[model samples]
Target: MSSAFGATEKSTRQVSTLRRFLRYVRPYRKQVPIALLCVLIGAASQAVGPFFIGWSIDNLIAQGNLQGLLLALLALTTIYVLGIQAIREQIVRVGWIVQHVLAQLRQDIFTKVQSLPLSYFDRSEAGDLMSRLLNDVSTVNQAFGQTIAQMLGNLFSLIGIIIAMLSINLQLGLVSNFVVPLMILTTALFSRWARSRFRVTRKTIGELSTKLEEDIGSVREAQAFNRVQLNIDEFDQLNAANRDANIEAVAITAAFLPSIDFLNTLATAGVLAYGGYLAVSGQATVGVVTAFLIYVQQFFRPIQILSQFYTQAQSALAGLERIFSLLDEPSQLNDAPNAIEMPPIQGEVKFQNVAFGYTPNQRVLNQVNLLAKPGQTIALVGATGAGKSTIINLILRFYDVTEGAVLIDGIDVRSVTQASLRRQIGIVLQDTVLFSGTVAENIAFGRPDATHAEIESAAQIANVHELITTLPKGYSTYLGERGAMLSQGQRQLISIARAVLIQPRILILDEATSSIDTRTEALVQDAIARLLQNRTSFVIAHRLSTVTQADQVLVVQGGQIVEHGTHQELLDQQGIYANLYALQLGSTTPVNTAP
Candidate 1:
């Protein structure tokens, strides 16, 4: 959780972050000028109202100029009504523009997330990314919709009042502004503190969201292990931290507004005392003194509003910092500058002296070499984390090799666009993933434009067409998240159907049948045999029975291929493969050592 905050350290590109944010406002360029005009009109109108009131007090009330007073009152009422309407119009237009800007921002963030490398996801939590997408983006929206307009409007109002005050009486105007410096000082100090606290609050909220998502997704596991109370205690601790951070932020805000109010009170008193002295000395009229008092109040009101906007502005900037930080992360995998689109492949894959590690100085695959001629089955058998999956990752170019190259038809995978390289390969993992959609849609995922006949054909080839017919809506039936509504075997069959639809030149089955029952395995095996008929295939299996017919079996251990031969040939060698095969069959006979 602390690491999450550490990751959001104030970026050096803060100015660029703001510049990019302003670019979002560019689309609303025409509307913005009109909106700001409305704001200006509203501020000027409000500033003139106090003059009309003072004129009526001095002329109509004191000198009994009834007609003049009625004219002044009418003018004040009209100005007040127009000002309200102008501000309302500004709000409506700004709201529309703000909504569009937020929509565009969210779309950009989502697209960037898609382009990021797999390693980024391996190190990031889904909840944290989602928080940025939802919560942080919404905060930025507030900056545009509420904070920006308020800041601008109040700024115009502040300027208008200052000018009106100075025009009426120079002495009182100068006195009224005595508190301006004090207010600025107060705001500067509090805002600095508030910004730091609000950043922590936002980061804490993200961490809490991440924890909640993780715990809820694994609730069943927690219950099975009887760790429910422990989970609750942990959540309570995070909740308390979030609450404390928020309270501290509130405390800073709580101190800020009142300090402004207190200064405002002192300034108002100064205006009254000075203006009364002027009225007594005949240096200023009663009406002018009264109007100056009203103008003073008007002056501080915007300052007060501006102070509050400052807090919201800080929060929005914090969110912007986080969002831009994410956008700044360069993808670990990228094609070379001169890379070309991979031509349609014949599926001859070779790993020549390949080596890799997720981190420096820690190799996961070491000096590995292997070859799969066109339309051949290469079986990789090893214990978990013995580099079986790493080989598949290299074949798909998910990660670049630390040394040497992976080639398809003698062209380095790194020299081809990833999309083009991956388009020719199909993969089915041990855990099949199906999105929330109709059975037909899942099968057609790799080819959305695939016709009904093509979809059914793929399903029939995977041996799941009969199962689809049994569903209430056949191919149109809705499968819930990850296809939870279907049996595991049914889901695996659908995944295979998806791969079959792609008609990929190279196919990878990583422990594809390890979790199914013997009956389902037999059915899947038959489908796989048909699917592998003419495609280059890589089969990784814990169940050696699945790899018995492979054209070549590579026994991998500790990031190296210890043996490579036909299944019968490896059994004759009586090495690791022979021992592993015997153990799976519940045989205890000691096999002869290859050494």
Candidate 2:
């Protein structure tokens, strides 16, 4: 009883996924019935063509009537021509529909990926997620682009052939089709086995794609460390696993397909033997026997194709399962039903006894409280893994607080729409990210409607105006692959210019100058200083220069604020902040605190 219940549940899930998939095709509903009609008409023509042969042989040939034979030939040709056209129409129409459905699915998947929480990406591989977007969706495309139309045509043809056979001679047909039950049983058993195997293949292929993307992205590191051989061996394991999965799928097909052919051969022998017996005993005619032979061969062909379609459907369904799984991933951070758009910011930011953790068992920030009135810069200085970044994440509402609240201008951050909140905040990270576009466009990323003159003004404010003018195309110059053409300082300038153009009320510079040389750091610092003016700002950095003049400095340790004061006041106390300041300035003071 338990097994039966499990099977029923499994069947229900498969149906659910299929129904979900069909919704993508529902927009093209009008075209679908037309395609199916073409399939039906094609099958009818294919099924009827055989009867003419039997009629011609019986009435025309046996009676030596040349005119009737010629007319039968003409009729048969016309029937087949119609079948050919209908089949072609169905293929073209369905292919168009499949491409469009796959396109929509991919667009929706990408949109979902963007809305997913940072925590989801924290635990998942970029490569694996990309595989669902490209590889898995492509699998569904390959399967359904050709399979659906052809599968329907084969099914209709099979049904028509069975009817024609039974109407011709019920007893002979019944005897000949004795292997039909065995064919179904064989197809069913093999398809059931193949479904799980193909599912494994889908996963293994995705894993392989993940490894490929990771290795390719880090090829420079591998070569720098002389670990190319190590990477090769690791990649080989994933590659071998993918190969074996596919080989098993091919092996199943090899074994299963031949069994269909073997059954068809057996059925043919039975039909020829019994039909001959009936003809000799005057229970059937010579032409009837001839047509039975033709129909018998034609019958197994559709069965074989349908069996092949079933196996392919298993693979397509597996791909669909993966795609749907991605689509079904919850956006753990969504707006409240009562959420309202955030008003224009005065940027009096506050973290009120906030507590948060990526997981429930581990808290990264505990009872963290802070306030920054509009237009003050707060520097968060801490050791690595010391909850400094978690506070910043809360400010951006990247993750909702596990407890307490974050507010902007006394309004709860979660109570406002995320888009509205984020638009008013600007971020520049240690590694500057720029898309492949003009220097002007990178700066105007947050404000796509910004005029070219406005872009130049922002660049001038960030002290990058001269650099842009020096580039071959000035502001129109293309920045390729995260602005690879630019130096580290240049990238930061572009990033700062982006922040400047937005004029965000709250600005975050997260180690924004960490990677540059002293000279470049100075330029980035100068740009950051200008960008930070007249905003409630948060700065997290490993360097002291960015923090030395902060209006307020908070020393974080063990997920709690150990000290908070102005830079000189913290230095005067000689506490955790003093020790960090001493270490970075090349002194030998040490401090320890409770975890």
Candidate 3:
């Protein structure tokens, strides 16, 4: 009884998940009809071929006429040629239709994921999301591209064969028909077992893919920690499970087929024996008996095909459910119904009692209030997870504040279009990200229409022009993945250059120089000085030295602003800011230059 309850629970979960997935197919309804039409035409061509064979055998031989034989050969040749051409055209058309539909499904899933609130990414793993977009989507396409049309065509052909059989001889047809129920029962049982196995097989594939993505993305860290064998063992466990699941499904399917073939053979023997009895008794002709044999062969051929189709259909449906589940997730945040565009103006930013958290019922930033006017620099300093970065996030509206208002030029950010608000800001992150493009292209990413002269000017301001010009292809050289070809400092410089080219009203520099050496830091600092001119800026850094020139520096602790003052002012007060500055100074310089 407990086992039955557990099974019911598992089935409920699977059904719920599958229903969520079918939403992805909703957009491609029009394409489905066209694909089915092609399948119908293909099936007609297939069914007609066997009849043409029977006609040549029966009509030409029974009459002993050369003219009838010649005409049958000509008809067979015509059907063969035209059928091949029609089927080929339909196959190609279906391929094109599947590509477009799959592309649309992928695009929708990706766009929806992007629009989801920051909390979604906080709770989700990068590897899992990647698997949904790539592996799961590919599985859905395989089912649609290969399995669906074949299933439909086989279904139609099976029905046509059944009708043809009954018309030839009722008793022979009844004997052949007996196997149909058994075949269906066998298919249902095998498919039920295979479906469960395929579901597990696909899930194992996802887990393996997720593990590979995480390990490869952090391969350097894994190597540093000497966990290479550990990752391999984890991967082996998943791959082994996947192999077992697929093998189990194949074994279950193989077990059903031999029984089906035996039944088919027995049905064929019954037809031959019974038809011979009728023929010798003068109740049936030789030609009728021959045709009945052909019909019996036709009957089970489509049944074999139907069984194969049913197995694949189960797998395809499972894949579709996974893909659609991703598509159905609603975004956590969206634009307000009457949201207005942020107007161009002098840079002014304000946070009024702002509070936020990645999850509900827990606040990471509480009642945090601050203001930054045009050309002013505000620096935030705190211990790790003290909501220093949270302040910057609220300012950028990456996640909306739960308690108070975040304003840009006195306009509520949430009431304005996100695009307009983001356009006014330029960010240079701690870990600089560069695409697979030339130095000029990376620098001018924010403003793609920027000319070569404009790109070089920004690069010069970021102090990267000389370094870029030294490359073999100058500004046109292609960067490798994530700009691995360049040093850490060079990538930071490129990020800065990209930001500067936009000429944004506000700038964000998050530990922008933390990854560089002292010499490169000095160069980056010079570029920072040039870029921050006449721009409102918010900077976060572990090194207190970077905030010395700021107009206002705030010490954050426990999600609140504990201290706010100028560098010298905070030093004199000797509060949290003073201790942090002293700690950074003690760490950055050696005691007495040698101790």
Which candidate leads in TM-score?
2
Provide the overall lDDT of each model, using Cα atoms, as 2-decimal numbers.
Answer: 0.88, 0.89, 0.80
lDDT per residue for candidate 1 within 107-206, as digits (tens), equals: 9889889989888998999888988999898888876676677667778988998898888888888998898888878886897788888889789878
Supply candidate 2's per-residue lDDT for 552. 95
Scored against the true structure, residue 465 in model 3 reaches a CA lDDT of: 90
Taking the tens digit of each residue's C-alpha lDDT, what string does model 3 give over 287-352?
667767776776677777677766766676666667666666767557799999889947889889
For all candidates, the clash counts are 0, 0, 0
Query: For model 2, how does the per-residue alpha-carbon lDDT over 1-595 read when each residue is reduced to its tens digit?
Result: 9976965776677788889999989899999999999999899987887777987888999999998888889889999999999999999998899999989999999998998889999999888889889888888877787788888898899899889989988998898789989998898689767888899999988888888989998899999999999999999999999899999998998899899999988988998889888999999998888888888888988888888888888888888899898888998588999999999999899889999998999999999899999999999989999998989999998999999999899999999999999999999888899999889889999999999888999998888999999999999999898898998888988899999998899999899888888887777778878888899899998887678889999889899998999999987887778777887888764654223
Instruction: Give the Cα error of residue 560 in candidate 3, in Å.
Output: 1.1
Q: What stretches of model 1 exceed 4 Å from their correct place?
A: 1-16
User: Whole-model lDDT, candidate 1?
Assistant: 0.88
Model 3 pairs whose backbones collide: none
Backbone clashes in model 2, listed as residue pairs: none
